[model samples]
Target chain A: MSESRLNVLKTYKLFVGGKFPRSESGRVYEVSDAKGNWLANAPLASRKDARDAVVAARKAFGGWSGATAYNRGQVLYRVAEMLEGRREQFVREVADAEGLSKSKAAAVVDSGIDRWVWYAGWTDKIGQIAGAANPVAGPYFNLSTTEPTGVVTVLAPQDSSFLGLISVLAPVIATGNTAVVVTSYEAPLPALSLAEVLATSDVPGGVVNVLSGKASEIAPHLAAHADVNAIDLTGADADLARELEVAAAENLKRVLRPAVTAEDWTAEPGTERLLAFLETKTVWHPIGV
Target chain B: MPQSIPQTVPAHGPDAAARLASMADVTASDAALRRFLHGLPGVDAVGLEGRAAMLGTRSIKTTAKAYAIDLAISMIDLTTLEGADTPGKVRALCAKGVSPDPTDRTTPRVAAICVYPDMVETAKAALAGSGVHVASVATAFPAGRAALPVKLADTADAVAAGADEIDMVIDRGAFLAGRYLSVFEEIKAVKQACAREDGSAAHLKVIFENGELSTYDNIRRASWLAMLAGADFIKTSTGKVAVNATPPGTLLMLEAVRDFRAATGVQVGVKPAGGIRTSKDAIKYLVMVNETLGEEWLTPEWFRFGASSLLNDLLMQRQKLSTGRYSGPDYVTVD
Candidate 1:
């Protein structure tokens, strides 16, 4: 049997608890490839899975965030390492997920891995680079640093699943923030495989969580979730992006709109990603010395 | 307690083209219109300056002395210390208290003294309580491409130094990229920062730099945007561009102010600055304002011209109009 046909025959399942398992809800739906070919019977993620994903995300946050910047960098870099080992699996998965050729898929996968390495190094250096000491009139010495904005819930882009997922996750996790990314609706298999790669890599569980389901069902929950400190709707459709932008305003959550460009997303300055995930914290300590 | 707009005709209509034509006729050969009306048995413009009619207050302030009579010095432009060159020339003008003409001392002084931001305190001290105000341009003046916080700080520092009016340039790149809301919000935020040290906002005039926008539609849109975004005034340009204040620009901006007042009842002043080097150019702007916005907006309270050499010509014109004998530089008062 051909590899794609053989792969499609395997019942698609949710990746959680460090393994791929049928959703506790036990419901399945046929998801099609971009060409309308039946790919697999993927799990129709339920609210329970979403709640469970949050649990996983919250549980993983402390250790992932508290780890030294160097350790987190090491973890992210390891994700690159594992993906390199399973390159063929990803090439087929990305091709089916985004309706691209195997060569194109391989190129995207390579770019995704490189993006992680680039962001991994940023975890340790972002603070010292963008912040400074303010010259206030009072006696307090004012110093500023950029901190990770906390749990960033991302709605990955509609197209370019693997690269979009990696681009969105890298910057968020690089700053010590945990993320729960909603997988592409029509083609989520590659996202599941990405989660598998992250699981085995040095990345601790919950630092990056992937959930596959209807974006309409998942976005409102993430946007309205008080536990999620920031949200990136770069993957959201027009209606969803607007709705998320409005919902995010309730708590004054820092929201980053989906990157809209026809050019190479990598060619743009990294500030668009870095600034979106960073929080400026100005500290004041009375100077008596 | 703001009242609804106090004018007839909807803000827009099917025949906007025709209405503009009628207004053109109403202002054309102004003398004939005035004459035909005065010839009426009961109608007259004579001795009718009462009724808040400040349009007659519209006059050009220039430096040239002696020409035709009735032409007045509406302002005395203080270009800069460099333009003034020697302190002797500046002290002479200051000592003269901005005399209207060498032949007479009865005419009032020009509206205000405009200069570089660094010289604001000096001008404020020099012109303090002398019925002349001090204005400064902020937000990096020409480009206005600074960070939001830094831009706000620059405005605050300028206002704290006694700049009664602040002229700022909007983020032109944002406007060009169709980021209207961002540009509007940025102007609003900067204007909010212009308040007194106690957090009370200062008077803000957003410079559209119409020369940069280069189109009537864009100028009109920018004017309305600035007005709606809480700008106290909408200025034409930064006075640095080649084609600063064209007749069409002033006309379009006046219509914007007119439409805004007809809708919101808030009267926003207009300043057609930049490249206004002659009294004639200055007077054309006044005429545009008088016709488009009507007479109520003609006072210095709602109108101004940012000119360096226009004031010299206006003064010389007023002297010639009064004395009928124009002379060299010695005939005019420096201060």
Candidate 2:
């Protein structure tokens, strides 16, 4: 006969530059479950946190974008493998966050893992689908290639914590762009847990920085940051999205406007998100005799 | 502290000659020089490092940050010391020093432009009448392994080419081997070479290469020795080594200069040359200078940052302040 012991709670922190650090401002807000039970204290990231995430993402853009597409695909596939191993923890987190039954949460978690694998397969093939050779009327070879548009700031959907988050985040990194993700403000636990899986799955540090805070608080800074090359406003409300879009115009950043309706996370995701953060570069070579 | 020493001994005068003669009495003998340097109070490594780390945590923001950025911009010794350096590069660096941010006309000019001895003439020519002094690194530079005569010739060449400042390196081997008088004598000889026909000498900045010294005590000793030998400024590193211009090392040197001024009315400048890149780091150093030596040493005449990349960072930060948005490397000119 043994006595019951107290449970050791995990301290959740923001993942930046592939390391877990507390918010630089030392602010945290309470995140509750769908039933209004306090789950944990998530870092209330400030503009400084967003600034630091942009720096990290910019620093990582060179190496991750320079790697062979096949290598990136392998790394993304490895993330899927790591996600498979942590399926139970994510299932529990999703169940509490989305107010679903264990079976339903497990189904969502499985779909998220499959979504990662689907993007992993797309990493190598995205270049061929997006780039081409030009038929110029000259004695020269003109070819167009795709390049990762430096650093991207991603706003993970507010309501769908796991599956929807993966559907938006995987395509950004799969195409070689490093991402600074602002996780779901109400339910950041699943996204933060996914950061752990990304860390162990052979993805390089700074490649995917996850900040758990309000999109409204952090998005405006990232949108206006000169170092950030693009912005995806999937998590922002209409007013916030419009404000971010206006701010993003300062740098002429590529902006992916938020969908008009709630996106279906379980449906097939097209190449729209994959091609959003890529820049096409064309080069000309003389045809020597 | 030792007895109050005399102020700077000018060249070619009866009173100045007497002052110079008296100054030589401190380094009159090798044993006396060693005794005087070792007699200075030993530095407490842990306490010094603790104070430096504490000073580094001060949060400077808004108006204070803006003022500090401008002050820091004016104190930079815009340097480009490489074997691959060209006249074109030196001219460009001088132009950049004249106006750090071409977009913002309000941005302050740097204190000087530092280049290799060969590029001094080009830099001086480009910076003619710009009010930004041209500084040349001489005395065999990062490695002061050459003979004393060769070192003096190097200093003389730069001074003859119209360099306003001569940044010379001390023989770290001699300093490490306990040959204090030889190193002191070498510095004095270089100071002699800095003299011009009109009795105005190019300001002599002595490099101690604190990374190779390996202890704070040695850095303190080196600071006193260089000041005693008439160094217009004492620099921390050549920026060639692995560890250059750390907070503790810079703080210790600043303390030495503050005490040196108290002991003797003669004030020497302090320059931490290497690895200080970001504006935040530049501000931390400014905070250290303001706290350690007060506002008097906060000017460009007493302190300088020997950097190349630091200018762009400061410019970027300057833009960030005015525009209310962060700036990037793409916004600043390529060095």
Question: Residue-wise lDDT of candidate 2 within B222-330, one digit each (tens)?
Answer: 9989988888899999999999999999999999988876665567789999999999999999999999999988999889999999999999999999999988888
Q: Rate the local accuracy (lDDT) of all candidates.
A: 0.70, 0.91
For every model shown, what is its TM-score relative to the native structure?
Answer: 0.44, 0.97
Q: Write the per-residue lDDT of candidate 2 for residues A100-140, one digit (tens) a residue.
A: 99999999999999999999999889889899988899988
Candidate 2 — which residues are off by over 4 angstroms?
A1-3, B1-23
DockQ scores for all predicted structures: 0.00, 0.78
What candidate 1 gets wrong by more than 4 Å, as runs, is A1-9, A17-21, A137-141, A260-266, B1-335
Q: In candidate 2, which residue pairs clash?
A: none
A241 Cα displacement, candidate 1 (Å): 1.7
Tens-digit lDDT string for candidate 1 (B190-230): 87777786655557889998888855556766776677566
Output the lDDT of residue A34, model 2.
Answer: 97
Residue-pair clashes per prediction, in order, are: 34, 0
